[model samples]
Target: MRNFEVNGINCVNCANSIKNALSDEFGEIVVDLEKNPRVVSLNIDDKDLQKFTDELDDLGFKLIREI
Candidate 1:
């Protein structure tokens, strides 16, 4: 799983919004709300990483870094 620490995920609703918005194209998305910056994890090819992050940005999530 590729995990990305991101901002703008304040609550469960935000997490769900991310999952709902990207899951279909990006596959299952796991958001860890317990973390300080929050985490969004999913399986994706390296070639698609940029696209994935871009999509997240389009949905109002900003990537801090990938883990």
Candidate 2:
């Protein structure tokens, strides 16, 4: 799985929003609440990377960078 650091994620609900909104297209997303700023792990094609970031932004999450 590829991991990306993200902001605006604090609790389960925030994590769920990501899964609900992104899983179908991007595959399973694992959100690590234990980390400050949080990290979301998932498998995504490089071709879809831009779309993935766009979708996350639409859900109020900002993809800071890959970790």
Superposition error at 50 for model 2 (Å): 0.4
List the candidate 2 regions with Cα displacement exceeding 4 Å: none
State each model's C-alpha RMSD to the native.
Answer: 0.7, 0.6
Q: Count the backbone clashes (under 3 Å) in each candidate.
A: 0, 0
Poorly placed runs, candidate 1 (over 4 Å): none
- Kindly list the per-residue Cα lDDT of model 2 for residues 1-67, writing each as its tens digit: 9999999998999999999988988888999999988999998889999999999999899999998
lDDT of 2: 0.93
Q: What shift in Å separates residue 44 of candidate 1 from its native position after superposition? A: 0.9
